[model samples]
Target: MHLEETETMHRKITDGVYYVGVDDHHTALFENLWPLPFGVSYNSYLVVDDKIAVIDTVKNIFTQEWLDNIREIVDPEKIDYIVLNHMEPDHTGALPKIAELAKNATIVFTQKAAGMEESFYNVGLKTKVVEDLEELSLGKKTLKFVHVQFVHWPETMATYLAEDEVLFSCDAFGSFGALNGKHFDDEIDMRMIESESKRYLSTIITSYFKFVQRAIEKVKGLGVGIKFIAPSHGPIYRKDPTWVIDHFDKWSSPELDKHVTIIFGSMYGYNLRLAHTLKKELVELGVEVKIHNISYSTMDNVITDAVRAGVIVLGTPTYDAFPFPKIWAFVNEMEGKRFQKRPIALFGTHGWGGGGVRKLKKYLEENKFEILEPNVRCRATPTEEERQAIKTLAKNIAEIVK
Candidate 1:
């Protein structure tokens, strides 16, 4: 009801439902989910009934408040199950503390989640492994587990309540904004929630669209009413479950447009000028082009463009005879994710030996990318001749897309 109340963690949703979305002050590298915007909340839920069940737990830093929230509803010892829908640290960081609180409760998760629990926490606790479509009865309500692997992690899952038609969707169908004394989906501005939700999904869950689509299809087939979708982040999707599900459907489809993304790091502004010239030439040739400065652009945004673009062009000014650090890191991350089957080109302005283009080309080749022939590279500054060469290369990129 009050924003200050949510500061200490509050509860909402149905009469039997409660939530403890703990504030996480992670910064730069840790706090942001996937894309690293430096703010987020690790949501945990307490489903009160004849046999109480805690849907998920928060990060270790918020364990005390997490327990206090549980204590407010019912004694921790009375909790019958701790349903683990995901094993990521933000969601499972307080497993040890939660295990201590719910001493008699069994940790309900998929077999993969059970295996991951050992890696997450060193605590010894009893775990009850469930497979796809496995149902666990909790007095009047029954929770069904559906394995949703590779949405982000192999151990991820979603829990459904048969009687209430509520879905405990962990990490799926979630947003980034912290709750402001409102827990249900309908209470928040749908436009703001949808925008944040799209950003979060595009940054974190873009790569695993196939698996996410499969999970969505499986859930749809269950014929559950799905009146509410209580994800483990942001606001709960109680008002419009279909809104999030439809978003996943559209994002996961392979019907995106053709475009070119040029990511580069320029120290002296010469390389940036070349990138801009190339973008202009490409657009003149009737190609949609998006350019990003590696130092300022987020890799998540790059990845999102990469998924929809037909070509990826990397430009970098040589730094100690190698590509720029951000450019190198970007390539390494994309390579590790096995991002392939796209045409790639390299361009750069180097002062001395001009090694950046060669090094980037080798890296893209090793990463199994279809290297476009005759990449554009300029030494020091581009002359009119070199500018013409870049324009030609842009045309080549457009031709490849066509």
Candidate 2:
């Protein structure tokens, strides 16, 4: 690779179709993904044909590299259109700079996306707002837009190239890894990318799955042969677009495994021991069980499993007559997201007067979860008798599901 090509990995997907993938480091908002600890990538592409079109721009910090990438493909001034699949800064932060470079290029986006442009950059830029299923001609090539609202954002949409069978999926089917010399889905590490993709979808997009299901159906209805899926982040899906479609299909459905997720926060070992007992008894009843110590587990992963499991059991030791702070924070986050219609059971280790279980039960009921019978509470460290009582509670949970 030449110095210029190394700086910007630009490859032609087919005759007259090229994509420039840029790397970005976002340390603040996406802290959970970093340094190979958790990961994220900001991807942009440039298409060169009879008329040049730049798909999306990278972050402001990567503006120079992004612009240089576009320049390598074609003179920025010759670019005809800058497609805005999403208005998120990770994708649109360099829009103003790109607009300045691509002087006369028209900005194509949904109506809501056009409105978002003002918030991101100063006024006075030419923009063309297209509605759902609207098609625009770029010389011999044409791109169509499909409105996909609430699949993370109101202005989000998927751009389809009629001739190439490629879909520029914004954040809808993206993962959390940077592409290292590899651009196509089949060429890269499948297991790692698939796991990261699931983490991203489960944590960030799980709440709006119904809209995602509708969007999937919409894409399926188009009857277009999607040979490539170029998302705004992670490696582009070229070999298998159906892989992402399958993932979205499974996640968007309400289907869940016959497993129980028991999450708890305990200052001492009392609540922890109770959690183990509950898991053991549930396992004995032929139910798959997962136990997470809240103090150690990341909230994002915990919530991901919670959303996938059929039953959720929360155990928190009483602190100042209320649930532990970590548990409180977790529940607060779940409530803010409007989590609904799941079976939940609450238990706590308390001293003196035990009001934490009752308090938690009330809050759980308010959040639309069906509170199972008993809502088991143990006084301080559970004795053998208390352990036996927990076994009965686990049986009740199994019966409730059955």
Candidate 3:
């Protein structure tokens, strides 16, 4: 079996490395939770040398396409290695099929990932468990592995190709958009990638921010010259790989943008009015402001805005003597995602009682959020006094963000 004498859709990263990933414009939601407005790509790569290696695999649904992509470059049976950097289905979904075809291929991954193979696909294939900073020779090119656990998964790792200087960084520096016809950073609109990358980090990996920081540091410590960063998703960073690296570092860092995000859940128009008024006031004070009605907006965008803002203002009308369920769920997501501690302002309205603001403040405080003063509680509509209190809250927020 040798390289097929056929035309292929696969794109080249360098002389020997090729992009065999597939784009999914059909999956409306990623993980059945986060919205995929721009769709996404399940990236896979092939490095052809004396010993052929296939890094990562596409989603299960695209198994045939993926195999065809590989066959166009080289016979599947000729593949000497099938590397699984993470156990997630999106990356390993084609594993069962590929392992069956690549009879001579050895599946390589970390110890934890090896243990998960059976539970995931039950494919009784030959395996080679690698360790942290381990290196494997592929004739002229060398593959190096780095363990970056809890980078959204317990068994996640990254692979580096020495000769071509490419890093197969599973999901470390990934985004949400599909590559489409363009595969390199220089070939596409970076603005869309930037925004989508932020949303991706916030919704997909924000909970593992600490591990992300560590992973970035670990990759840096490798001291390898990475000309390209081929992840399991999104575009390959070849023109300016450091640009994505800096972005990952900045997003995971403690420093935040000097902006305000107002999230409100209202039963009637009262809380919405309050949220609008607050946004107007903040804008008037020359502070950047983003407002979202949690009931109308999706969680992906809401969480993305919430994570980037320096200050967060939550407004919710009382329901069943508690914060509105939507607002409560948003707050709970913040806690579950381990949102960085930041100053927060709480406000809401009630028909019979005023438990919304109090409950929200308590929960936020318990989560280490710095509760700003003037937890405004209104009844039905805002009177002149309540409006004045809202102004005060806006001023306080402006001072902090500005």
Candidate 4:
């Protein structure tokens, strides 16, 4: 692995393709909402084929570094193509600079993504519009375009290298973590990959649940013979390309895990007790459980935990005749996820009347959840009867989740 003066590392992905991406540890947030505590990588690829095509561009903040990396493998001026699989800013930030260096390179992207790219940068680079299953030949390698719409963005697409059996997935199957000099999944420890991938999907791809499934099916149906997956983020899957796709298929499906996520908000600690009680019951019933206090935890983390659960438990304390403000906001955000039909249990404490539980129940029903029978609600503290009801609620949830 030879490095340039700027420490530019251009790794050979295959005989013809090279990894020319850079890690972004300075960006505090992804999309300005999801936290990037572990940092992320803005991946780009260099396809050294007949005409020297660059797969994608990096962020503008690393323009010089990116250009240096490109210069390491091939003359920037010799590059003839710049492919845009998605129109997202992170992937297109260096377009203007790159176009300047690779002066004669033609910008290539889907017909649908062309408008967005033009509107995004308005750089007058000669362009080539490709369609789904469209083939672009670069001497020895044949690049096939697979249109995967709404995998997160409206015009998002993926590029497949036919000869190499490598799928350069733009954002699909991407995780939010820097590569730390490693170029392939086979080279990195995968203990954290699953969680980070789940976090990325839950935060970025979950909203497009049906679209995700459709895109996966559309690509799989093509039978392009994928053996490597080079997503725009995270480690490239070389040993097993379908590895991330298989994970995406299961995540997007209707099937839920035999696990429960309990989210609770408490002002006087009574609501938290109910959450713990429910967790204990679920654990005793041989069900996996994770409890989180929404007040301190970010929504991204909570969403990741909730994505595959067989059951969801929402606990809150009544405040001003309604559910706690934070909990209500979190639950309201979750309301948009109407595709999930998992069993739900609402248990909370109200000081005077049962306003919190009533409002939460309405919200859950509005979101089209299959609410578990016998919800637990108590005034101030749990009475003997209320405790018995809580037990019943837990038992009913166990039956449905386990």
TM-score of each: 0.89, 0.94, 0.96, 0.95
Of the two candidates 3 and 4, the one with more favorable lDDT, higher being better, is 3
| Candidate order, TM-score descending | 3, 4, 2, 1
What ranges in model 3 sit over 4 Å off? Answer: 1-8
Q: Cα lDDT of model 4 overall?
A: 0.85
By lDDT, rank the candidates, best first: 3, 4, 1, 2
Candidate 4 residue lDDT tens string, 1-402: 532332367788889899899989889989898999889998999998887888878888988888888888998989999999988889999998888777788998888788897788878889999988899999999888888998768888899999998889888989988887876888877777887888898888887888889988888898668888999999999887777899888887878888889999998789888888778877887878988899889988888888788888889888899988988877766766543777888988886766887898887887778788788888767889988887788788788777
- For each predicted model, how many residue pairs clash, with residues at least 3 apart or on different chains? 0, 2, 0, 0
Worst 10 residues of 1 by lDDT: 27-36
Q: Model 3, 1-402: lDDT tens per residue? A: 112422236888899999998888889999999999889999999999999999999899988888888887899989999999999999999998887888778999999998899899978878999999899999989999899998869999999999899999988899999877788899889999999988998999989989999999989998889999988888999999999999999998878889899999987699998888888989999999988999889999999999978999999898999999999999989988889899999889999867999999888888788998788888978899999998999999998988
Winning candidate number (lDDT): 3
Model 4 lowest lDDT segment of ten: 1-10
10-55: candidate 2 lDDT, tens digit per residue: 7667767776767554454453432334446677777666777888
Clashing residue pairs, backbone N/CA/C < 3 A, model 4:
none
RMSD of each candidate relative to the true structure: 2.7, 2.3, 2.9, 1.8
